[model samples]
Target: MEELLRFGIVGCGSVAAFHAQAIENTSGAVLTACCSGNPQKARTFAAAHGARAFDTLEELLAGPVDAVCLCTPSGLHARQALEAMAAGKHVVVEKPMSLTLEDADRVLAAARQTGRKVCVISQLRFQPAVQAVRQALDAGAFGRLVCANLSMNYYRSEAYYQAGGWRGTWAMDGGGALMNQGIHGVDLLRWLMGPVTSIRASVLTRAHAIEVEDTAAALLEFENGAVGTLTGSTACHPGYPRRLEICGTEGSIVLVEDALVRWDLPIPCPVPVGEGANSGAADPNAIGAAGHTLQIANFVDAVRNGTPLLVDAQQGRQALEVVLGVYASGRTGRTWHPETP
Candidate 1:
């Protein structure tokens, strides 16, 4: 029998619950430890999850866990991930791995140096609908992809930003809606559509009185000559489901909230039939734990056997680059191309 993989969670926040639940659901994985900035909260979380609580990440790393899930603020991912890797532990870091490309690269470097596997949380890819789309794309079902668009209209009140002191700040939450909320779509888009060559964008803090943008739009040019648009806003009232539209010479696909709503293709590709995945359109906590569960299962398998991750540290950096590209274009009011590393 395979040895059980022990897991640790850092930063016991709203999202950490999802990680803990996912670990509980995955086979051959157990949550053994957790840490949080708030000692009492950590103790409470530990008691609820049947795990040990630590006052610091260092203490958690010194424990018996073989992996660490970083559910911390966006800004803390890179540093904490590096520390975990340095301690010979695998890492499952939350989205937008780091605020800067340099830091993302640093994390990647640490992963290589430490020979530790680093998985980034991009649970959307594990959706059955997304898998079907990817399979069709791979089989040339989407002939010569022409255009793709992503729309994320989410609503987070001013109180939401105020509740989390780092929510709207560039230092912690990174960019506002696009980085914090829209990155999942961004990564999914880039993964499906291919490498983006150039981008022109505009960002604004139209609704909230925050340091970062609540509304943003961008025009993208892909390496395959596909043109696309990306729009995200936390200010949009009566928040609507996030949508992704991918078009090609053969046909097009429209996915809303990770469900294949429309599938028009020349070939007979299996239509994904199921209930739509939960969306955090109006409330961040509305998202379900299924995707997280699948991802944690994959991470456990990857650690136990030598399987490759669906979203590795490098892919995480690619997503971060696209996000930074949007921010750069928003700042200069000109087209920006991702810098080659």
Candidate 2:
């Protein structure tokens, strides 16, 4: 019989519900406990998920959880992950891993020192269309990729930011549109197009009255000599579907909200077009738990069978480097060179 992988969650916020649902949906995975800054919120969350609740992360770490899923504020991820790994538990962290490259390095260092697994949530990679495109790219079907472009135009209202004290701050939520909402696309761009060698960018807070940039744009240079553009905004009216275009010498592909809308290659795509309908463009809650479920299931398999993680801590850090590079360039008006990962 397969042993159950006991899981605990930190942060009972809105995103934590998705983690709980994912854990519940995954085989050989159980949500045994949870913790949050608000004890009542933790208790309520745990009760809804049939789990125990703790008032603090330290108490949760002392319990019977084999792994910890960190759904806390962006700034808290690396510190909490390090604490969990040090306590002899594996970690599944939310996206961007950490706000800065230095903190991300610390988390990776701790994971290496503790010999514990760390998976970062970049769940769109699990989409069938995305997998097919990745396979095509890997097999040299794309033939010398030349250009990649990503558009992540999401919407978050003033009420959304005002509801959480930490939402728009640089210290907690990290950067606004790109780091908070567009990172999935950033990760996809990096994964599909390869390492980002350099970036030049501009950022501004145009919509909501927030501390971070609600709109951002960047020009990127990939390691393979591919030039790409990334534009992210929480101010786009009616919030259009996120789009990605990959162009190569042989063919080109287009994806809209995880769906492969265009396949210009000679061979047919393994998956049918427009299969995935999920999107978080206009509403964050609309993204659903399908991707989370797939990612958590993969994490369970890795923890049980010694399989490789789809998005490890190092890859998480690499993604963070791209976002941070944009921020640095925006602030300094210089071309930022990201370290090769």
Candidate 3:
């Protein structure tokens, strides 16, 4: 029998709970330890999850674990993943893999150097609707993508940022609405549209007092001659489901909260409809374990079977570059092209 891969959860914040539930539900993995800056919080979270608590990441690194699940702030992902990879542990990072493209590329380079498998948590890729689109794309149903648009016009209350010290800072949380909240859809847009050749964008802090923008908008030109727009805002009061619309020469589909609200494809392409984990469009921490569960399970299987990951470090970096390009375009007021590392 294959040994169950023991896991460690670093940064015992709210996002770690989804990982905790996922480890419990995963067949080839188990939660062995967890770490948090606050000893009391670490102990409490560990006690609740049947894992040993470590007060520091260094201490956790010295302990037994096959992989580390990084649930830290958005800005810390690259550094943490590199540290863990250097320490000989696989890593799984939450979205916006890093705040900057430089950081994302650095992490990717380190992962390659260490030969440590690193996966980013973009669980929407595993969602059924996304899966269907991927399949149809493979089948030539969506021939030559024409245009794509993604929006995350959801709400996040002031209390939401006030709940944690690291919530709305530029250093840790990175950008506000787009970087922190809407990145998943941003990634989905890039994934469906292919690599971007250029982008123009603007970001604002219209509604929040944070160091980052509460709203952002971008226009992108893909390598395939397709153009797209992205709108991400936390100022959308009462919160609506996040939406993604992909238009191709032959077909188009619209998704709201990972659900296919519209499906129009040429030919007999049937999109399989199924529920994924709650993506926490409104509540940042209200995510479910199913998507995380599937991603982590697939990661473990990749480890055990030497298979390719659905979202590896390169894919993660590409998504980060797309988001960062928007920021650059916003600052320069000129279209920016992503620099490949």
Candidate 4:
């Protein structure tokens, strides 16, 4: 049997519970400690997982742990990840890796310098349906890729933003809807379609009275000549199912609510199925937390067997680059290429 990997979880919030459960359930991983700025929450989170609690990350890092899972605010990701890496702990961080590309680069550099593995929490990639779609695309089932469309229309009440001091702020959470919620779909789009060459975008705060834009739409031209449109927003009432559609000369595939809602093509596509996989259903609340266990499972395997990380730290930064490119394009009112930076 592989040796157990002790894990220290920083940030004892709602999302932290998911990581705790995932670590507890995965083989060769033990949730040894939990940390939070709030002492009470940290204690509660640790008790729930049968682990010790610390009021700060420094205390958690002082414990015996092989890795740290950071579920902190988006803006704080870089600093916390770097600290964990510097402590000689492997890190798995929540997405949008950092608020800016520079911070993202810093985190990546730290990982390299420390010679420790760093992974970004992009659990959407673990969804069986999403994996199936990626397989089809990789197998050329989507012959001669043409165009793609991605939409993320989710509602976040004022109470949601006010839940945490860093919720809707640009400095912390990066952007509003695009950074917080739509980033998964955006990353999935890029993962399946390939690198974007240029982007033309428009952004606005349509509904939420936040500093960042609550709604954004963009057109992208891929280096491979494929065109795509992306819409992200928190403006819709009650919200709607996030959807991603990719079309090629042969046919198209649509994934709605994490499931393959539509698959129209003549190609013999093989579906890569897995056990205990979440059915890609359309409940907004259901999809977000469902993939954590699978993600942890994969991470533990990678740690033990030296398997490649499911979502490497650099790929996470690349995904952030695409989102930032859209913002840059929106600001400049001109198509921006990700490669330029």
Candidate 5:
């Protein structure tokens, strides 16, 4: 039998628990060690998952581990990933990979220089609905795509921002709702559609009194001449379901509750991607955790079998560029191009 991959987690916070549980559940993988600034939290997290806990990343890296998952704050990802790569471990980082493109590029360069695999945690790519859309698009079902719409409305209380030191800060969390909350939807938008060519956007902190915008909207133009709109907010009370709609000359499809709850194609199809297929049920609270677990499994499989990662670090950077473009466009009051800087 192949050896079980040993995993180390750096940052034992709320998300870390999900990663720990996922690692514990996945076969051919084991949660060997964990690191966190708070020794108590680390110990609690590790004990619950049947893993050793360390007070610092340095100590964890020195132990036996094949990969390290960086669930640290957004701004800290680049540095932590570099440290892990330097320690001769493959890395998986939570998204918005870095605060700036320069940092994202730096981490990628380090991974290449050190000959380590680095993956960005964009778990939405693992969703059944998303896979269906990708397959349909690839099979020319969405012939000549014309428009796409992405909207994520979720409430974030003031306490949510105050829960951690890095929650609502621009330098740390990158942006507000767009960066921290809605980035998955933003990534899914770009992934199913194509690369964004240009964007005109507007952002503001309308709802909560936070440092970053709680509300944001943007107009997007794709390289393939398709136009789209993205609106995200944590301000809306009794928020609506996160929805994505892709329309083309051929037909359209809609995904609700992270499942292909609605799909209308021009013709009937075989095994409508993940239909009746069990990836398990959708749990909003565990969505990120589920995505993270699937992502981890894929990364480990890729390393062991030489398969491709669902969302590589490079793709993560590209997704970040789209979000940044929206912020930049909103700030400058002009269309921003992802290709530029």
Candidate 6:
């Protein structure tokens, strides 16, 4: 039997429960300790998971744990990952790895310096449907892709943002719709379409009273000569599922909510039949824990065997760059490239 990799969960919020379940689900891991700013909540959560509760980060670091999974707010990820790595623990963090590309760089740098593995949670990439799409891209099934798009439109009730003080803040939650809600699709877009060259964007807070935009639209130019559009919104009512459309001279494919709803091609496409492995459609927290479990399983193998991760700390920055570029273009009312300041 493999040795157990004890894990400590930081930030005892709603997402922490997912990590806790993942830890329970994984074979060679255990939830040994949980930390939160609020000690009572930490204790409450800890009791349920049979973990020691600590209010402060320092205490958790000093505890008997081999790794730390950070479920903190957006703005806090970089700092927490850096500190945890400095304390000599492998780090796993939730998405939008950090609020800015610079912070993402710092987190990756810390991981490199410490010689510790850092896994950024981007489980959507592991979906069977998405894997089929990647295979199609690699096999040139699209025949020099002409256009691709990503749409992450869902409704978050006014109360959803109001429920948490850090829900919509620029300093913590990053941007509103694109950063918080639509980013999973943002990551998926970049992963599928390849590196983006330029983006012209328009953003606004159409529905909720928040510090950031609830809706954003962008024109994307890919490095591979593919032009595309992206729309991310939390203001759209009836809470629609995410959709992605990709077309080429040869054929096209459409994925609704990560499921391969439409597949059109002349070539022999060995596409997977049935629903996708992800259901992160309308409700943010409604998705299954299988993705998290798979990623955690991979992270453990990486930690034990020095294997590489598909979504490393460095790769996590790409999606964030796309998002920041959109926000920057929205600010200047001009097209933005990552190379541009």
Residue-level lDDT of model 5, residues 1-341, one tens digit each, is 99999999999877777777778767788999998878998889888888898888999999989999888888899998988899999998888789899999999899789988889887878866677779989999888999999988777777778878888898789898889888888889988898899999999899787788999999999998999999988887756667788999988987764677556786664334333322212223545466667888898898898889888888998888998998999899999986655
Cα lDDT, model 4, residue 176: 82
- Give the runs in model 4 whose Cα sits over 4 Å from its true position: 269-285
Clashes of 5: 0
RMSD of candidate 3 to the truth, in angstroms, is: 1.7
lDDT of 3 by residue, 1-341 (tens): 88999899998988899999988999999999999878898999999999999989988988989999999888788898889988999999988788887788788889889988999999989977788887887787877888888888889998888887787798888878878888788878878778899999988888877888888998889898989989989988877778788888888888877677677888653665444346576777666777899899989998889889999988887787887888889988999986654
Q: In candidate 3, which residue pairs clash?
A: none
- TM-score winner between candidates 2 and 6: 2
Model 1 score (lDDT): 0.92
Residue pairs in candidate 1 whose N, alpha carbon or C atoms collide under 3 angstroms: none
State candidate 2's TM-score.
Answer: 0.98
Q: What TM-score does prediction 4 earn?
A: 0.94
Runs with alpha carbons beyond 4 Å of true place in candidate 2: none
Superior by lDDT: candidate 3 or candidate 6 = 6
Where does the lowest 10-residue lDDT sum fall in candidate 5? Answer: 274-283
Q: How does candidate 1 fare on TM-score? A: 0.98
Estimate every model's Cα lDDT from 0 to 1: 0.92, 0.92, 0.85, 0.83, 0.83, 0.88
Q: What is the lDDT of residue 272 in candidate 3?
A: 50
For model 4, how does the per-residue alpha-carbon lDDT over 50-167 read when each residue is reduced to its tens digit? 8999878887888888899989999889999898988889998988788888888898888888888888888888887788788777778878999999988877787777778898
* lDDT per residue as tens, model 6, 224-312: 99999999888888677888999998888888765788788665546665556355545678877877888898999898887779889
Our tally of clashes for model 3 stands at: 0
Residue range with the least summed lDDT across 10 consecutive positions in model 6? 273-282
- Mark the regions of model 1 whose C-alpha exceeds 4 Å error after superposition: 273-277
Q: Number of clashing residue pairs in every model?
A: 0, 0, 0, 0, 0, 0
Q: Candidate 5: global Cα-lDDT? A: 0.83
